[model samples]
Target: MMTNAIIPLVYGLLIGKSNDDYNQFFEKLFEQDNFQPESIMTDYEGGTIKSVKEMLPNVLHKAVWRQVQSKGLATKYREDESFRLKVKKLIALAFLPVDDITTAFDLIVDEFDEEADDLLEYFGKTWIGEPKRRGTGRKKPPSDHKL
Candidate 1:
């Protein structure tokens, strides 16, 4: 079961062994009364990201990452000018702290334009690093491709 919460106002239980299971869980939550939420912050799990995008299309989804000691592999890549810049931009986008999506995007743009290297590095080390994947293997494809 995957649980998501927003303090006193909102909390959700997403019971599932697979992506479809959680998708159904979220669908039911949306149907239920008193379940509206402004935004959701979650670990950078790909399935959760896809489910949130499909189910809560209107809600703000922020990917959260915890600080961890780096293996210095990222630093090795830092020597490559283009790769460093790309990583810096992505890291900035991933780490900007804001209450909502708009502010987060704004911060990312501002930092990117200003070339805030320190901020980008801090974000890279803490939040913008590679995400960990959880759960089982991929789901079976739907019979029809066209919607």
Candidate 2:
């Protein structure tokens, strides 16, 4: 297997991780030229997402992943083999073609136990915005391709 190292072309420090700060930083980075990136991968950070949407509207911006520990699922992920594998299956949904993702997500979630509901809810709300209250499709559905 091959691995890629992520190196930043531009780097800097910002006082805060708020939308304003990220907005300003992105603005500065792109203001000078019509530089458009093909896509951007960012951890699930609200401010960063907002900034990217505002600053680089045409570029594809994806929320890659949220921290498993932060979601209080680390223990399950560490010790419960079945739970861990299910979580990984959730993550693998990211690689599916955009049009097929909703269906694939439904199939994956059908296998999860009730204990994984919270994690599933978080993922559904964050990445797959549908199957919401009014639409009523059911629950809906991240990750490195090679993981």
In the range 29-134, model 1's lDDT, one tens digit per residue, is 7787877676766555556655766676545323221211142334434465654454444534423333342344335545343334554445434443322346
* lDDT per model vs. reference: 0.47, 0.66
The lDDT, on a scale of 0 to 1, for candidate 2 is: 0.66
Per-residue lDDT, model 1, residue 76, is 38
- State TM-scores per candidate: 0.34, 0.47
Clashing residue pairs in candidate 2 (N, C-alpha, C atoms within 3 angstroms):
none
Question: Candidate 1 at 136: error in angstroms?
Answer: 39
Span of ten consecutive residues with least summed lDDT in model 1? 138-147
Candidate 2 global TM-score:
0.47
1-147 in candidate 2: lDDT tens per residue? 557656556665778989899888887877768667756766567788667766765442233234456667778776988877777666566557667767787888899878777778777766665475775564433332222
